[model samples]
Target: MAEWVHDLGGSRGFGPVEVEPGEPPFHADWERRVFGMTATVMAQGRANGSEFRHAIERMDPGWYLASPYYEHWLTGLATLLVEKGVVDREELEAHGAPSFPISRAAARADVPPGAQADPFAVGQRVRVRSFEPRGHTRCPGYVRGHRGTVVRRDGDHTVPDVEAHSEERPAEPTYSVAFDATELWGSEAEPGATVHVDLWHRYLEAVE
Candidate 1:
């Protein structure tokens, strides 16, 4: 049995686990378009579904606190259709594709690489350099310009920021870098404030 854990929003713990293979991959631009549309609807107080709204209302604070903005967008989309009556539980199970569809041309451009990035060795000193911030940045608002050792590096995957925008552009590779909690949050943080953020290769540099 394959059990999946998801954070719906709010303070309650993760809800009943679902058994599944996993979600299919999507182009970065498509994700962005979905997010932008969802935000627009939300701003208008007309989000798509009721179950989605309820899930959003119940999402765990911890997941909500740590997730990227676009992640919230993806989550919202999943919840909305169910609540709105656009899709049913049985329909969801039977449907081959997700509610939002992407063009075939776009799909071809977003395939994952045959090879993946390797994990970082423990205790390696690394630095997070500043770049012209745009679209979406996984580096927390508090961690820019901060120096920290590379606690770990979970590497080479499709960059979510770009995939979130697949409707407009192409998906690219992103690296997941883990930083020591102390480096990002300072000594006042709890014993485990370590944060692992997915960063594009373009966002990093080596420090002397």
Candidate 2:
């Protein structure tokens, strides 16, 4: 599927960003509750950060746009809680969560074999793979199929693309890929502008 307008990418257009001269951390009491609950649930280990983000990414396009930022967070967090059997829709809709345990499978799942390779080095030219993912993916919509230079090797870490789907932990090296603004935004982009995106090894291919 093509990336939606809501997806973080070059194609997504935003009206002028609103500036808050002095913004409070949260706008309202409910927003605070939503933020706090999401944090507490993730901290309790009922869901990992990757899974929560994926849930948010998978939200319906209409709902995603129609809701406020914190509402989206609440929606994703609630969905994970129910899906993990921590709470049911009735309880969740009632604005109450029953007792829930941290997922042992998530903390102790065995790492996938042969997932620690670190072949690419800094300053290497690589292209983001053009894969339309049906599952949770770390690759951003903007950088797919674009070539960029590996500006930094961010060391190896657990791959979230797989972890979002299951308890399995697969590790891989990550890098910061720097792309010229023109390459992504066209010649109209200001000269000397660029964008840096952190990408995992699986998202990149060596440029010969």
Q: In candidate 2, what are the lDDT values of residues 1-208, reduced to their tens digit?
A: 2465445552446676778889888889999988889889978888898888777766777677777788778878877877778877778646554532211222222222333445688898999877776666667777888999999988888887788878778777889899998887687878999899998888888888
TM-score (C-alpha) between model 1 and the true structure = 0.36
TM-score of each: 0.36, 0.84
Candidate 2 lDDT score at position 162: 80
- Candidate 1 residue-wise lDDT, 1-208, digit = tens: 0011231112235577555577544447767677677767667654423323334433444565576556655555655555556666567556544543211111122222222333334454456554333223333444456555555455455443344323334333345566777876577767776777655544455456
Clashes of 1: 23
Residue runs of model 1 more than 4 Å from their true location after superposition:
1-123, 131-134, 166-178, 191-194
Candidate 2 regions with alpha-carbon error over 4 angstroms: 96-118
Task: Tell how far residue 171 is off in model 1, in angstroms.
Answer: 6.8
